[model samples]
Target: MDLLKSLLVSASGLKAQNGRMRIIAENVANANSTGRTPQDDPYRRKIATFRSHFDKELGAEKVELGKVARDESDFDTRYEPGHPAADANGYVKLPNVNTLIETVDMREAQRSYEANLNVIESTRTMLQRTIDILKS
Candidate 1:
């Protein structure tokens, strides 16, 4: 593939990974958050999705960030009688966001982002070398 198309592919990947990281960070930040009222639901974990499509402009497959989906899993409950959001049974609804899972997802997104960055760097280097060869 041409250098420009390679750069475009890498750029798309970088954008997708960056979006995934943002979603993971938001989940981590709200892990301990509880609802304001017993009837109110706590923060739900968000999942990041990606879609691959053929780009006519680039004439290659490119990845993009898809819709942010909600985690339909049940929320965790903690016994906290004194808590304002506690129910009659002294159970407070906690976010389903698991810190460990979020950490792992963040790490994976970071690695993917780094890989795309490396590809862009390599492509740039090759483009520069080609220019130098032509000028010599």
Candidate 2:
């Protein structure tokens, strides 16, 4: 019974982590994206937040995505006089996204997702063993 509940909890974790990975991937995809106008801002990196809630049905504290918050850090500027988004001073505002950071976040999300998958797999194995024992 508790194992079934654990499966539910792990499923929630997998969902949350999958969402987090999606956000991270978006950030990475927009790393080189810039605005078309000089006065416009470039793409901003988004971070995924998680919160835990007690699920009455599963009787466990499950995690869920809270918000996709924007990164407030300053955008990196590059000297690109020919670029359309270049300012009067020939400086272009690049997206406030770092590939290294996104890569790290993606790896973390992948690990968390894998961990949840392992939990689900183990629980299913236990359930199958129980059924076999009963049949024997």
Candidate 3:
């Protein structure tokens, strides 16, 4: 029963991490996206959030992907007078997404996903061994 609960918990974590990675990928994909016009805003970075709650049936705390929030940080600016999205001052607004930070976040999410998978695998192995012993 405890093993089953562990599996459920780990599965929840895996799902959460997967969602986080997807959000990170989206941010990376739009890292260089710019506004079509000077008055428009560029792509905004999105942040993934997680929520944890106790599962009554599983008798364990499980994590889940929560609402994606937009980053409120200021956008970067570049001097590009000829650009279509350039402002009157010859400065173009850049997306808030930072590839370096996104890369780091992706790595962390991947590691977390792997860890949850490992826990699930380990639990399955232990359950299999238990069944084998019982059969013997």
Best by lDDT: 1
- Tell me each candidate's RMSD, in Å, in order: 0.6, 0.9, 0.9
The 0-to-1 C-alpha lDDT of every candidate, in the order given, reads 0.97, 0.94, 0.96
Model 3: pairs clashing at backbone N, Cα or C within 3 Å: none
Report the lDDT tens digits of candidate 1 across residue range 1-136: 9999999999999999999999999999999999999999999999999999999988999999999999999999999999999999999999999999999999999999999999999999999999999999
- Summing lDDT over every window of 10 consecutive residues in candidate 3, give the lowest-scoring window: 53-62
Per-model TM-score, in order, reads: 0.98, 0.98, 0.97
Scanning candidate 1 in windows of ten residues, the lowest lDDT window is 32-41
lDDT of 2: 0.94
RMSD of 1: 0.6
lDDT of 3: 0.96
Quote model 1's TM-score: 0.98
**Which candidate would rank higher by lDDT, 1 or 2?**
1
* lDDT for predicted candidate 1 compared with the true structure: 0.97
